[model samples]
Target: MASRPGAWRNILRRQPSSPRKTSTISHISLPLEIPVEEETLPYYEPEHYYPVHIGEVYESRYQITGKLGYGAYSTSWLCRDLQVLKVSTSLPKFPTATDREPKIYGHIAKINSTHPGQALIREFYDSFDLQGTDGRHRCLVMQPMHMSLLEMMGLNPRPFDLPLLKMTVTRLLIALDFLHAEAGVIHADLKTDNQKSTAPPPKQIDESRIIYKSRKFGRPDKAKGYGLPSLCDLGESRIGATQESNPFVQPHIYRAPEVMLDMPWGSAADIRNLAGLIWDLFEGEHLFGAVFDARGGHDPFKHFALIVALIGEPPSEFVKRSETTGQCFDTNGNWVAHEDEVIPTVSLDNLEKRLFGQEKQLFIQFMRSMLKWMPEERKTAGQLLEDPWLQ
Candidate 1:
């Protein structure tokens, strides 16, 4: 029988009169009848969501208190046990990264380490499958986290102060070192969104669908101390020292030059990615610009031109190593572009306006150490921890 046109939108229940309070749930002062979460997306369907309701319990435990947030493939809810429940969309027979995510956590768990960064990596507490209308949905129980660094950055237009910047960079480097040297994993997608500060939640409702505002994650006063910064989202992570033949990795703007030229990339790619992120956090703007084409898509050639302008051309040996270097450069390892293609005129020194004298020079040196044309030339996460600038 055909399901009703919007049967899946049916709300199982309205708001829970009394939510269990293992943690606090601050309510946002938004409209009572806001739009349904995850309803407007083109790919969204009724069966894709696991049909959660406030006060509903799963696995004979873990009662849902409020909706946390929704992503492309999953919706997170704050639970009664100081846990966030991430229920993934139903999957096909074939396995995907979401399927492997729990196992990746297991791998990290197996590594016995006293590294301070170990605690900085988010880990799933438990995982189980829920039988949904279409297929089984994988649910991960995770510690409640505060706000993403990206969201945090949006709260303040000004760049992060030097103390905050130092703390952020040091913690990230330590976490990366732990993951690379101890866990032997590659966080291929290290960005502001993937790094979150640990914390604490609060939330609306209807019959056809539950209407609620996304809980606000406000920045706490710096006087209270910025919470421990932790890295999350291991679904895209890879478990190897050196990853080869992976054509696609990292966000477009943060993508390393080696990955752009179709060369082998390893943990060093993360160093480069972090360099870009650090720039974004400290400079209050992205370091690289004009990477998007007319259609608003990532233009690799334009990206290369920007890189060339800022960091100078890729070394000849580095150019020869790439499988598809011919697309932008000639056989002689010299850049070849159309008559209209314009290389940027600004250098790093010119673009960086926040610092002066020795401080600026040291900062640029720190960035260059990670943003090298050759992957081998980039410093490891541990080595970067010892950098005088960071100190």
Candidate 2:
């Protein structure tokens, strides 16, 4: 298997292109037996480690292929369905965005899409509980996808083209639309890792490397399709009607103003995240970049300063609504001055001009609609779908 091996760590799944060297890695299927010694020289240890290994069975049904990833409280494993792949029975599904929303798995694929800017959700297959070394963990069996948007962007220095970014965001927005409208769910945590469309960049991948096994993990045949964008990792998702006293939680870059400011968030929170997500997808960076204070504090104030710098100041009324307003800003609606330096504010128009030398009015306007400090002022998923700039 090691054709000419040094250390077989990553599988280089190169995408073949026409005239240039543009390649993508959309899927990962690992062999049953991985031969690296667990005790191989290692200086680092992860905080949370699950005991899932190569060639294990779970729920007496799905065979564990490999570990997809792990989060603070959960682990995602690639499990092969022993039932075998059925073209007619599967009916092409979108894996539910996260393990929390078990019902939303097949719902996305069934929805009729008249909207122009949308992508399919990942298809879900099955789920069961597995007892790990820690405790009982939920194991979701779903269709496999390539690396996340964040992973893909990191693969290439150049940001994604406007068309591709817009298209992918549209698909994301539509997924939110379905979750909010059809399913009445709120994806409290929405970011690049949870959104999948483009595959990670691979090197020197060829046809010989392509393996076709009807019993293989994930949708192996889906390598060369149009690449449907889908939301993932729904462990944080909650039904809209279900009231939550949960604290602020989301990646620092995508954290909405209200969440940082200690305000009540709802479906609007997802919209706010979508704003940051869009900027990240296009510019390959967060609209509100992260920073540190003089005291090395990593709190809402520092995060909020980044927001103010990029999207302009929050409304005074919006500040009044926040319970933790005093934490980040003065009564004048100005961010508390840092002990070290003055934080500067930059509008999207200025950002566009600084980068592209001209104003992107439509793009700016579209972002403004979602970047509002007030959750109510932000566009709903349905409203975002109809935003002029999305087209």
- Taking the candidates one at a time, how many backbone clashes does each contain? 2, 13
Global Cα lDDT for candidate 2: 0.55
The 10-residue segment of model 1 with minimum total lDDT is 1-10
lDDT (10s digit) by residue, model 2, range 50-123: 34443545444555544454343444555565221111101012223223444444334344545332245555
Off by over 4 Å in 2: 1-49, 81-119, 194-226, 241-245, 293-297, 330-341, 353-359
- Cα shift from native, residue 85, model 2 (Å): 15
Error of 1 at 355 (Å): 0.4
TM for candidate 1 is: 0.84
Q: What value does the lDDT take at residue 213 in candidate 2?
A: 22
Query: How far in Å is the alpha carbon of 306 misplaced in model 2?
Result: 2.8
Writing each residue's lDDT as its tens digit, candidate 1 over 1-391 gives 0112232122122332222324333444335544345665556776667667667777667898777777657788888887888878876644354676666677777666788778888756777777666776777778788888888887887889888898999999998999888988888888876422222212133342343335657778878754777888777788888777565788887899888777778899999999999999999888875699888878887888888888888878887887588777776667787553678798889989989989899999999999998888999999999999988
Q: Residue 210 of candidate 2: its Cα lDDT?
A: 25
User: Candidate 1: misplaced stretches above 4 Å?
Assistant: 1-47, 194-212, 221-223
- The lDDT for every candidate, in the order shown, is 0.75, 0.55
Candidate 1, after superposition: displacement of residue 7 in Å?
38
